[model samples]
Target: MLRRANAIAIFHAIRLQPGISQREIGDRTGIDKSTVSAVINQFDALGLLERVADESRKGRGRPSEGVRINGAAGLMLGIDIEPERLVVMSAGLDGVPLDVSEYPALPSESEFAGGVSAAVAAHLARGGSTLAEVRSIGVCLPGLVDRSGKLISSSNFRWGAVDVAGELRARFGQKVWVDNDARGAGLAERLFGCCLDVQDFVFIDSHSGVGGALYLEGAIYAGSLGIAGEIGHTKIVPHGRICQCGDGGCLSAYISGPALRDAFRGAGLVANSFAEMKALAEQNIPEAMGVLDEAGEILGLALSNFINLLNPPNIVIGGGLAVLAPYLMPPAERVLRRHALPEGLAHCTILISELSKEPHARGPLAVALQGLSQLNADGAFPW
Candidate 1:
């Protein structure tokens, strides 16, 4: 177990800091020199890492060799299913994407699968690589996925009891893994986002509905049944509006995109989308500010409770809500100051996701890379 942990740490160190020396890896990861050297040799034997003479540092004390990830060692595939599009990304071992394909999303599962398969074929054809050369495939679903990779439910797609992993494996003829899109997004934050240096954090993703993912104890913490971090259902108001989850006064009923839109309509205003509502707020419309202020307070209260309970060092608000952090975070911070414990509130920092493009696509790509890490740890080299 210790060896596996060291291997994973050394691998991530090289991945995060390419062209670093073995000694620098030991310094960064705090692994002893001998262990770092042993693990580097093992990775070299597996063709996962490469060491070359450091020409730039020729005058260094011992002329340390530079260690870097071998991007050509293997390839991983990622499929992200969104409401409007199906995204397929082919990535090298170094987590850099080689190909990204976007297709119109379909209503039926089989149709979506067909679209993904065709896109995969086109991606492979352009790269001159076959399915046999792919390491593994990771699928990101917008719903609750059980430990067995069965998508138990998805309110967005109205999908339930779907064997997503099995179906994808059957179609692709490779090892496939499935995870909740929100959890995958949190993983992306840890591996490649602002939270790379943070260990314990909470990720709140707001879309048509609000969801969350928790990183605890240096890994993704899906509770016993893999249904933890449903922050949307944390009740903020007693006997408040009814939520689709059959709960009253839940955070989802107050701050979800649909909830915000409905709040606008309830105030005798018409806002077909959150962007429209944001524009109204910019106009200083009384009704719009009122709704937003109320929603922010409720969200803040819920976040305060989360902070009190988990005491995570950081909190990231993403998805559509991130765009409105300017309006929401202020009130939310006020609530945190008022309600959350002083120590916890003082220690935590809230930030927005800084994703460049295809955020959903990036999560599944990270998931694939994480799966590769686990595979390596288990003495199973997919390459």
Candidate 2:
């Protein structure tokens, strides 16, 4: 286990800085040279790292060598199941994607499951890799995922009590792990996003629906039943609008993609997607701007409550609506400052997610890599 920790640290450094030297890995990771060497040897045995000599160096001196993660060592498969689409990606240990595929999400449960399997197969074929080479598969669901990896409910996808992990494992004959999409994205943000510097943070994703996760001390607080970070359900407005969750004035009802589209429709603005809404707003459409501003303010008020309770140093907003941060964040910030405690509000920074463009795709890749790191010889991830 200690060797595993050392390998993870070294591998993480190599992932961050390709062509980094052994000495530099030790300097950056604070692992001693001997321990670094030992761990690197272990990784070499596992086919996870390789040393490449600097061929451009001057003739007389010994050639300097640098290390990089062996891209072909193993692959992680990331599958993100959305209401409208199923996105898949094959990524290396360094988080560099080799292939990606997308398919329309079918309403039939069996067909959707088959589509996911076929997508993975096609992605692997494009990359010339196989199921045998995949280290693990991470499935992202937009619902309440329990400790046993069962999705209890999902209004967007209309799923209930599905053994997601078990199904994937049975299909692929490989390790499978499952989690809420928001929480999976939060894990990615911690490892590869702005939260690297701030351990205590909240990641809110405003996709087709709204969801979020809380990270404290560099790990997610999954709560007792793994439903802790469902921030979108928190009531914001008193009896304003009906939410899909059978509640009134939930934050998701005001800030999600469906909500924004609903607001646009009510105002006589035709926007089928968030992109069109953004375009309308950029064209100086008053109704479009109003819709976004109102949503932002509602999000800020909801987040202010989160701040009062969690006191996180950073709050990252991602997913489709993140593109509207320019129009949305100022009003949201204003509301946050007005409602949140002075000390916490002063310290917190609200920023758009760096992984906003394809968070759903990158998130599951990150999760698969994490599960790969935690696996035992029997292909089980021990929490």
Error of 2 at 202 (Å): 1.0
lDDT tens digits by residue: candidate 2, 93-183: 7777777788778565556567778888887887787888887788887888886678888866776677777777788765787888988
lDDT of each: 0.78, 0.78
| lDDT for each residue of candidate 1 in 275-311, tens digit (9 for 90 to 100) | 7887888999998888888888887898899889998
Model 2 whole-model lDDT (C-alpha atoms) = 0.78
Candidate 1 local accuracy as lDDT? 0.78
After superposition, which runs of candidate 1 have C-alpha atoms over 4 Å from their true positions?
Answer: 1-4, 32-38, 109-115, 122-129, 267-277, 356-361, 376-383
Candidate 2 at residue 348, lDDT? Answer: 85
TM of each candidate vs. truth:
0.87, 0.88
